[model samples]
Target chain A: MNGEAPFVPDERDRALMLATQEGLPLAVRPYHALAERLGWAPEEVFARLARLHAVGVIRRIAAAPNHYALGYVANGMSVWDVDDERVDELGQWLAAQGEVSHCYRRPRALPLWRYNLFAMFHARERAEVERAVAVAAVRLAACFPGAVRAHEVLFSSRILKKTGVRLDF
Target chain B: MRERRPATLDDLDRQLLWALQDDLPLCERPFAVLATGLGVSEEEVLQRLRRYLAEGIVTRFGPFFQVERMGGAFCLAAMAVPEERFDEVTVAVGAFPQVAHNYRREHALNMWFVLAATRPEGIVETARAIENAVSLPVWLFPKEREYFVRLRLRP
Candidate 1:
């Protein structure tokens, strides 16, 4: 997923994005509402969105829940020092789990940082998250014995800031 | 920060949140489509969504863009600010528009943040600017590969 090619949005697409980048309209017929604003046919609006989604530009149109507000108080970033030869395999296995929110293979900053696999887990309690991590570790060991050397779960204490990504264009 | 009781959601709320985790249909009335699936009226769905947004339960409702596909880049970076200057350094770090989500975690590298930039080089440039401003070395961990990224969460 990190090797995705570039997609330069043309003028029309740019205009379409600029119109709804803040958010999709809340009206009963949001596409039609957007069409009215953009002075384009409702069909065109839907078509553009469909095309963007098909090409991987837009991942999806959905509600992003505030985990903390929804009672997911424990946010742990579980990092693992797995075999470099099979880190990707381990990452895929971990990422497929329902509890792993985000998983990726990152570079290790050695000595101080030897973990290359990062998986984020969220739960209502710290203990629950810890247990989940332990279970994952055990399962990983079973899948590939001696593959994982060490792991640690870093729990976030506070959210200093969390404004979602924004693009001027 | 305001504290809300954990697991206070009713069944309807849970169902609605779970339903929304899937990709919303690209139709004239996306919410209406979702409402039908949940056996509720379009108006009710909209009302609940509005309430959730107003109450801070839902942070955002819209398209989830893959910035990398749009010629942008994001990196997870960390800094270890001294105990005495954590607050001051946080303000300095937050000043950057590229710094997206910043979190305070318990570790030697206590401060972790994600930087989103229009181009790949922008991430490095922003990190350097942050280092100069905070007078601390910022360690970046760019993803070599993404196994999976769940855009939505079920509470």
Candidate 2:
């Protein structure tokens, strides 16, 4: 799906997204805590959250580890130039890979930018990240010559700033 | 709980991380369920999570929703920041509240970031502001489409 206004936000979903972006309180009953704060029953909050996850609006209800803290200092944003027709399959293939954290197909800015598929890889060392990229390169080469055009990985040198997307108000 | 450095991920810690990354079961007792399956007590699960949270190992532990679905806007923007002014431009761009997920990548488009705003037009305005401040051309690559966006780093 394009990053557009695809889903209609009901009142409950709005409230849930508004609250949980700060993060769920680390308590024995986080849903209960949310219910108390938002003036909804714990069951309703839980069920609605479940529905959000089911519909793919909520990507996950899990812990997000900081790679830096986990000693994964190197992060490579690998971009691939694959045949438009075959990108969907390649993206799905990359998504299934444990090394590729994020895989997406964006509009290719031709002439200047030739890549379409973007997959991110993380590691504690550059060598490890290089190896991962090398494997991807070889795999891409195995496909038809024009099917996989070119690939490049842009390793982030520093995180000038980073925070999750949240509603300001 | 015993003391461990930031780099070290003990046996229990690794298991806890794997649980958190892949499938943190959406139940009343997510920790309890994880503990039961991983052969640990609920208290231990919670304790490790708290530690992970405190130490910044885990950035967020909750439901992640799409910003666009809720009326917010986000787009990926990149710029070719000269090496001489790399750090300067980084700090200047990072100062904006609308900008998040900024990075210095190894490419001609060295500076990359995602700009998120409460409104759609705000994203464009933020991009312009970045260009003016850095005195560099800002390329806006709003996702014409999206195939997948998931991050599950194996511990």
Judged by DockQ, which candidate is best? 1
Tell me the tens digit of each residue's lDDT in model 1 across A1-169.
4456788777888788768766778889888998999999988888889988998878888887777887888899999999999998999999987778899999999788999999999887999999999999999999989999999999998888766676545
Best prediction by TM-score:
1
**Residue A84 CA displacement from its true place in model 2, Å:** 5.0
User: On a 0 to 100 scale, what is the lDDT of residue A113 in model 2?
Assistant: 80
Q: Return the DockQ of model 1.
A: 0.66
TM-score of chain B of each: 0.89, 0.79
In model 1, the runs with Cα more than 4 Å from the true position are A2-4, B1-7, B149-152
DockQ of each: 0.66, 0.46
Model 2, position A164, has a per-residue lDDT of 61
Ten residues in a row with the worst lDDT in model 2 chain B?
A: B1-10
